[model samples]
Target: MDELFKGIADPLRREVLELLRKAPLNINQINDHFGHISRQAVSKHLQLLEDTGWIRIYQAGRERYGYLSKSAFYAFKDWVDAYLQWGAHSIDNDHGVFLDDTAYKKGMPLTQPVMLQALLSKDKTFDGVFYTAVKTTGIFCKPSCSANPRPDNVIFYDNKDDALKNGYRACKRCKP
Candidate 1:
């Protein structure tokens, strides 16, 4: 877990993970996403991500492709789940502490309007940040998915499991 945290501490590494989340990319393709960073620097970050099991590298001929390893996040997810349950129970207790329930009731925060605009525009920049689930179709997709569902019928989830927990299936087209 320490290694995982160290590996993801760098903003560049996090960006790499976001890129990999969309699809596996060879080093060159990954480099294309960041013109400001050198190939060597990106390679170094990739090595760290791979060493920490956050990503997997596949070599086909001379090309090496980096793929996001979702299993690598299981430990962190478990930790977060434990705390989330604890927090929920604590919030439910009628004690001195008071909290806002509007965001929770909405399934997300007020910034959802911005997310919806990004979804409607098929913004690749927000690909890993959130997922849009269409109530009518009962399917969730990555922000960059080409399918444009009605914005009014959409709800956003921070991760695939959350969408799944809410009974939304993965989009066949985007495979969220």
Candidate 2:
């Protein structure tokens, strides 16, 4: 709840999130929509939204387009639903507050390379979920490796550090 509230508390980010919720838009488009703020300012707000898991970005050719990310909202919804239901049987809630831990308990999210290696080693295939570092381009792919294969000239990263070391960026889709 703190995270969600803190994220939307910013006026610029709130506006950006509102715009992105409608449709994906390039940085220039977002900047144009709010004429008062410079493009870099808009990008900074978008970056904060992204860091807080409120929005996402996708690369189209050379431009990065932004969109709202609703996963955090979904997590908040789940937490509130469970809390209300459980409190119905527990102590009355007039002066009580509870910390929601379900989302954090889901365990460390596996990296793309680790998941990919596991799938390949087991001879299994999945279609979604992948990771990339800012270093690589034209190689945003899935953990299952079901996408069209890239040349061997493309180095494979076994973990986030390896990818980041080479400057590859994470894919906005699948929430990598």
Candidate 3:
């Protein structure tokens, strides 16, 4: 997903992820690792990581702790593995795979364009008809959720189980 790619694409955020991979760290502790960068900058990186599902932050009284999300890491790994497999087996100069309408439409209730439209409008009419998963947030919501996910970061599933199987969490707000 675009958000997963964007999350690890940043050098600084990657460094932070490397740190969290070793063990959970509190806010001040994570900040200490980057002495050259202001604490605010470090905090912003942590926020991005959390938003993109690379990390999860939880409050413990006064101390907030951060930890890597293994599901997120595994999702990224699976994506890379698929890409590597595709590249390795490709014929000379071969690239791209295009699916025709029948292949693309075989099992969907609503077309993608309509799904995007329904999602943007928060149309309750489509609730339970399909779910929209926001890649950046790693959460899926019903069409009625009060969310305006960017079209590029959205993935649609006829059922929530597919979204969960692909490593997305149900949105607490919508309980989808």
Candidate 4:
């Protein structure tokens, strides 16, 4: 658990995890995502993530693939869920809802255009990061929501409250 926390502590490692969320990639592919960071640094981060069991690396012929252990995040999610329930009745301020600072610093860029593309592609990588609200239907949805809405009628919000505040209701399908 300590190593898991330590591995996820770095912004670069989190970014790597996000990339892996989409699909497994080789070291070279992962390195391509971070042009500013050297390959050596990326390798070290990948090693740490593997040690923590957040990712699994396998070799197929000469190329090595690093796959995100999707189940590994469930433990962390359960821990957070417990805390959220514990504080459910006591807390204000949107129940601790907030954007990840590391994501912003690392250029996750939840811009409208970027989000629209993710929505069109049904990108699961951005599922919990933002909600998309449709202007025409007045409903908000998760990024991976199957319901298709025109890009012109969509707006992205950082939290559910923001979507609600903007006159959008939660989408029944995605339950955003």
Global lDDT scores for all candidate models: 0.79, 0.58, 0.81, 0.80
Show pairs that collide, candidate 3: none
Tens-place lDDT digits, model 4, residues 28-88? 9999999998899999999999999899999999999999886679878887876677434
- As for TM-score, the candidate ahead, 3 or 4, is 4
Off by over 4 Å in 1: 91-176
* Candidate 3 global lDDT: 0.81
Of 2 and 3, the candidate ranking higher by TM-score: 3
For candidate 2, the per-residue lDDT at 32 reads 95
Which residue window of length 10 is worst by lDDT in model 3? 90-99
Clashing pairs in 4: none
lDDT per residue as tens, model 1, 1-176: 88889889999999999888888999899999989978888889999999998999999999989998888789779877665654353343333222232323334553765576567656555677789999999999998797878789899988899999999999889877
Q: Give the backbone clash total of model 4.
A: 0
Those runs of model 2 whose alpha carbons end farther than 4 Å from true positions after fitting are 80-176
Q: lDDT at 46 for candidate 2? A: 79
Worst 10 residues of 4 by lDDT: 95-104
* TM-scores, each model vs. reference: 0.51, 0.44, 0.49, 0.51
